[model samples]
Target: MDLKLQKFLESTDFIRAVKVTVAAATPVILFSYLNLFSIGFTVALGALFTFSSDIPGNLRHRVNGMLASNLIATGSTVVISLATINPWIFYPVLISLVFFLSMIAVYGQRATLVSFSGLLAMSLSFSHSYTGWALLQHAGLMISGGLFYLCISMIFYYIRPYRYAELRMAECIVLTSKYLKLRGTLWDIRADRNKITEELLSLQIELNETHEKLRETLIKNRTKGGSSNQNRRLLIAHIELVEILELAMATSFDHNKLHHTFQEHPYVLNAYKHLAYNLAALLNELGQSIENRKKYTGKHRPFQDLEAFRKAIDRYEKQTHTSGRPTADEVLVLINMFNYVEKQAEKIKVVEYTFTHALHTQEPKHKDKELEKLLTPVHYNPITITQNLSFSSTIFRHSLRLTLTVLAGFLIGNILPIQNTYWILLTIVVIMRPGYGLTKQRSVHRTIGTLAGGIIAFGIISVVHNSTVLGILAMTCMVLGFSFIQRNYSIGATFITLYVIFVYGMLTPDIQDVILFRIADTLIGTALAFTANHFLWPSWEFLSLPTFLENSIKATRDYIREISVFYNRKGEVPLPYRIARKHAFIEIGNLMASFQRMTQEPKSRQKQLGQYYALVVLNHTLLTSAASMGSFIQSRKTTKASEAFNAITGAIINNLENAMELLKEEKQNIPVDKETKEMLKLRFTELKEIRKKEILESGGTQNENFRLKMEEGQLIIEHLIGLTNLSENIVKAVKDIRERQ
Candidate 1:
């Protein structure tokens, strides 16, 4: 069996989805208790709607998000149902509700979900007629039904307060281990660094996301006073795992240096590569063990070659001395590489020891004294609604567009020969989006998904006459659909379509007509959505590329400044630097995502995209090297290297900023300053002289700082080279664009 397949089956989502499936059907199955059987249908509707908002997060945030959705559902169902009693009032009120809901989308994705769920419920409620006390009763029933699901949510929260957090931590461990394997591949001279870097950048983005989640979850489970935490063991283990990854994955190495030494003496690194593989296997084993709350069953002899690799490098230095003049920098490079792998092995042992003991101890001997310093969970606040409330805002335009398109769809549904008019409304709400790229992509998927689902549902309806069996199938489809919505949209849409079709088929039994009408409704809704997407204040990703790129440049600037500050202060890292690093990562991730969406869009819209892509790739490379050195710089003592670092960093930053400004102005042919280039070279030469004298006279077992400074100098040199290359390309990208223009 494939290991990936095994992991997927064991995921927390798979388990939760199975639970949701049972929960969805439980209400309907238990409806046989009372003589009134039809109430089960309404209860099922309430459950399905509530389940739509059951997104993953910390337990408290998850419950709050759902509760907010429930409140919206209750209020919207009652108000929208009452308003629809008069057509004159219904059209304006419904349109206004959709417009306002769409405007709230600027708050964020979750806020968007809560608002859109209300819109969906309101639209569906309009299909039935209710007035006065009957309308209030219908709203009351829906609220009561939603309350039942809320009860389930409460149980879900208490049963496993930290399940999602631990699952994410497990995923982080697994991905980092896999990334280590990818890095091991880079040891081969024939490896494609470009391809590997792309994969690494993607994984880094995912790791960032998981780190963000862990930060939030840790805050939630933290107790106020000096009591033992429910999650202390896991939290401590997670921090250990993070440090292990920093040593394993983010510790910067001179690739050329390694390659150069490897070409001369391959035996030196043979054990190092094997150690990496050993750690990969062990980390993955640890991940699986953590997920299952069991001991690590895998075995490996880690750091077995620590002595051998050291001896091999020692032998190389002696050989170099006999054959020619052996430079201190060169020998130190070999020793540094040797020490890196050794430290990795050591870190792995620490992780292994932590997991083995931290999780099993009856009472923790020590507590997380620094737990107060951890960042709190980021929750959605309504402050954003007030910040950007103008007509100029994208959210307002999207809301206005969504409202107009919905009104048109509603009018057509009333005129057309369709049994389920609300399906059209639901389709539009589901498929249409604020941006052309997203809406067009969703339009294609939704149409394809509906056709495929309608056909399967048609076949099932043709043969499955027993309503109970159909209900079971529909409930199964619904759960699977909801599960895949976050994982895979097209697959989720297919199952969701089938669920909706089956639900309606039990009432409107003409299978052929039902399928035909669904296809027609989907096409109509998709067409209208695409039309509105194109003609409205349609935001294209291409138009937004320059803005995101500019922001990326700004983030890079702040990050470099933070690096300077870290090296300058040579103490505990400031909180502002951490915040800046986060912003840098987030902006780059946004740029990468935007570039990806641009690729998916039509070709004509992607002018200069290739050049922009080159710039993005270069920026990502610089950050990757920067990411490697962020923590390393903090741990180093202030030395003579800091002065040269200060001297050279300014020119590079100035050149990079100038390039950014040139790109923003859409100009070309920015020349590199002769003084900057000369200064860069002169400073590196000075550092080499400072290092060569120290290394030439130093005995073999000196202060660890001596070895650290050697590694740190090399790291700074490599990053400077990267910064020079990327800074040039950032300018050249704009030059390329100018040529095309």
Candidate 2:
């Protein structure tokens, strides 16, 4: 098989699309052959709704979610079908159901999906005026379809239980390789640092998302029962990926300073860049090997590059010696850079051996109840829904907007002489999201995609008259449409439009009218959704950015505090430290995503743009630097936390706390103590002197072990000083944003 195609086939999304297509289309096709097309179509709808609730998770959650969706969707179909008898009854019932169902999203992601299934059923219920027994028959068929889909899902899980988790891990590994490559490119002398930095930040958000998905898939299963060998291997891979990311972040240095220091010798910097790129390539190859279920046997050895880089550094020192050049600090910086590369290479070696040899690195196992805390907690309590009843809650506001917009769409469809009025409601439901930026984006995509699809569908109908070909085309579109719906909405919408048009074309002789109606109803729906989002309590990103920023800073603080605790007590990294690190990454990713969404919104709605941008960059640096320090401590044997280390970490945490307080509108300037600042400076000076003495004592031929120990001490001091400076800057940046507010 072609590698790309093989990867796609192995993906969880493709598998899901296949399951959905089979579940939905099989019933319709079979029943239609039996001249029971109506029942078949009803069953198809039921299956699709239940499929929507089959989100990624453990077996129990997956089964329970689909079952709940089956019940909810069936109830919705029945209630809406019965109420459609009277306009007065239908409008009130529809409005109340929309509000209640949409508000359930406050419960969590899984609940949101289950709620979406209910709303979808309600929307489709408007398509026909089925009364009494007809409604009961439809509901029954829907349950049958849902049950059919549930059975298929369980069978697939039984056949390949680790498939989803494995794919998720593969994705994270591949993304981490890309991340390493981007981080490596920062060493390029001619690279566009700003653009690369933005890409790195964007990639961080994606990695965080994938990490959460892995947690949902792997952690949930491990918690459920005794984990199988396959599950344990995947869990270990995920843990390594997380730590590898930290190693990548930790390996980063002050590029500006590096560039300035190497201004006269760009070749040395190029050597570093080359080694970094080689490391990335090695990692990428390993990821591919994992994805392909093959052993990675070092097709391209980065160890060679590491050796070459070491040689290059030796030559540079030899040349600089005659020129009376390269000060002591510069030599120390070189050692630091070399140490970073060597450390990363060593870590990658460990990962490779573990993967290829199937070595089970000891991983801590949590009990079911304790492991649940690792996944994003969902509150099933009714109070969670009731608390979001206020307008201040984004979910509540979104629910209200959806209800009112859907009601208006229904009314407009009724007033207009339109066929398939449910299309309008479907459009409204599909286009409107909780946030203005996404809603606006979807409205545009939906409008363009519908028109484009209609034009193409018209041409296809005009040119082709074969029923077999049309059926094939529609089926193909269904598969592609389902595959892209979550991955790429615009492309999904286009294919879905084609699927709809082709299906309806077979039923009606007036294909042109069908096309026109689809286009018109879509336009109406998009307009209503866009208008409602803008004018009806729209959730803007800018207004929420401050809260995100505060959360990011707070999480960063907690993460650093964990490192501080570890500094005094070094051992294997504990679960609390990993949890804190995970939360920090998540919060920073959220802040970055919020800023990105704000950028997409109208300029009038974007506030303090430059300041927000600065904060994003600063927060990223703060987290990365802290990770550098933390990872270094974890990976190596380091001295106990001296008073200087304690003072510096305390200052960093204090700055972070003050930043949060400032975001909360509490103004206070808490500078690093003058004595503590001197302490850091004094420590750095002392390290340089100690390094000088070590070189002299060993007659400039110190054993590698002794040299590494000296370098580690110098590196620790450097990281401490840099972190102290960064944390103080974060304080100033927050104060500046506060003043603007």
User: For candidate 2, what is the TM-score?
Assistant: 0.92
C-alpha RMSD values across all candidates: 3.8, 3.0
lDDT of 2: 0.84
Clashes of 1: 0
Which prediction has the highest TM-score against the true structure? 2
Count of backbone clashes for each model?
A: 0, 0
Q: Candidate 1's residue-wise lDDT over 1-741, tens digit each? A: 566676665566665676566655676677756754556656655655665567665556666666677678767777787787677898788887787777667766567877777878877876776778876766666666667777876677678766677678788788878878888888877889888877876776787677667765664455332223447656665666655655554455657667775577777677667777888888888888777666676587676657767777787777777887645667766665665677677776776676676354443334333443455334457776666666556687788888998899989988978777877888899988777788898898888888889888888888888877877888888877876766877788889889877777766667678788888988998999999988887766777787788788788778887877777767777767766776777778778877877877778878778787788887776666665566556544546445677776776677668767776654556776787778778888887777677666666434676667666666667666666666666766756766676
lDDT scores of the candidates, listed in order = 0.72, 0.84
Question: Which residue pairs in candidate 2 have backbone atoms (N, alpha carbon, C) closer than 3 angstroms, thus clashing?
Answer: none
